[model samples]
Target: MRGKYTIKEINRIPELLKKGKEYKITYDKDKKYTFIGCGSSYNLGLITTKMLNKNGYKSNVISGGEVIVFDKVPQTDIGIFISRTGESTETVKAVENFKKRKIKTIGITCTADTTLTKVCDETYIFEFANEESVVMTGSFVYILNFLLNGIKKIDIIKDAETVLSKIKEQIDTIDLKKYNHYVFLGYEEEYGISKEGALKIQEMAIQNVEYHEPLEYRHGPKSILNEHTLVVINSKDTKKEAKLAEELKNMEAEVILIGKGKDIDIPYNNGYETPLRMILPQYLGYKKALIEGYDPDQPRNLTKSVILD
Candidate 1:
């Protein structure tokens, strides 16, 4: 039962997504949106904001800590708070700030009867995507796919099982012990996915991880590349990104590209397929944890929710 929850949750993603399609989630085209959350939820907000902005909506993201401590709530017509448990203190408090200003609020969580649902103007709960593990695996992809579907119908759900199988095969062939440092690189929405990828390795495998925009790696970050580093690039299929991957490979770093015609080879369906790309890191992190003798279900010094007093 060490990694039971993580594996179960990851395998449940396709089922959760299929159910998400029938969920009555709503979005407003006329309103500007601000998303607030912490950790995995915050990283999700980043991907959501990028997707919304790219699809002709005005949206931005901020961490719940910023809203509570620095009062960094931006002026926007709508505020969306995301929390897996819906009871994270900073996230609930941030929603309260939005409520005080009379801004329309939305809560996206995997739990229904929680503090977030009680405060927000609207709440969308996907309890099926909820996890028993401290680290988020399926719920992250499920919620992100939910938001992406709200913006535009995501057809990738049909291919999720196939994608997961392929990723697992690729991961099984790689020797996890060979790499000590993990780096994830992407651009825009993919950059957020890369950040989440890095977090997954750090949390579950307890390894050194870094994330940067594909080209940004050249700006001093490349100096640290070595034979023991494994770089996962969430590529945009751009020539520059491809060249960078080649350069890193030549520098003796292992590079796995997750875009058209690359290592993972998932079609970049205008970023709608971004959720599928996440399976790579999720499986990698889980496998790496097993290799390192860490429990992926209960990552060290972490919890299911951050309920600060």
Candidate 2:
């Protein structure tokens, strides 16, 4: 319940995903729309935009507040605002502005009765109390996975389930405390996941963490690595990135390969489940952070969401 969710909690993720599916933009196919996710939710919006684009849906990620107040969003545009608390000043103002114009909006949040939820035409409530700490843990993974499962084609859902299962298995095996610092590396399809993973480590562990694509790491990030630097690399396909892993190992960096890349020893193979699968080692890191006297749920100087006015 603290570090990783129990099996029951994990199984509930699919239902949460299906609920988000009901709000799939059927009416806005021809209309211009944007995704407005604040804070960590912004990262989710990035993943959402990419996935939607892949599935033939046109979308973009912009600050919820920026889209409404600064940018002249078209009247026909729809807003998808994501916040854990639904109380962000910018997000609320953005939703309110849209409401003034009678623009369509959708709110994704944990609280069903928030201002954003009340104003939006539709709402997807994650209802996960994986909160209570400043930094979001289970809630982030849960909501992102929910969105992915919901937006993905129905046929692909089965594959996604397998991937989710694999993530669980990988999480069960990873030894997080073996290394002091982590440098997450990824490229192409897994780049965003690498960034997200790095953020998780920072938020949860508050340790020395960095992320770069494999090529980018070699450019400059490689200089900071040593045997103590746990190198976590995510590739869309591990087999293809094995050579990069080999290079890292040759450099004496402790390498853990994820996604489509495979090489050396540390492996967390849980199939291709996108960001959700990426949650594995991250969850492990959270546990490590917790054991090391840091609260993964509440990192220093962090809040549930920012209220940028």
Which candidate number maximizes TM-score?
1
Q: Can you give the lDDT of residue 262 in candidate 1?
A: 81
Candidate 1 matches the true fold with a TM-score of: 0.97
Best-performing candidate as measured by lDDT: 1
lDDT of 2 at 80: 78
Candidate 2 per-residue C-alpha lDDT over 1-309 given as tens digits, one digit per residue, 9 for 90 to 100: 454433333444454455455444343357655677666787777776676666666777777657656854544477778888888777777776666777778888888687778778888776653455566555666666666554543323454455566655655565666667888776533566676777777776777888787877778778878877777777655454667778988988777676433332223322125545455555555666766777555566777667664
For candidate 2, give the lDDT of residue 213. 75
**What lDDT score belongs to each candidate, Candidate 1 first?**
0.90, 0.64
TM-score, prediction 2 = 0.77
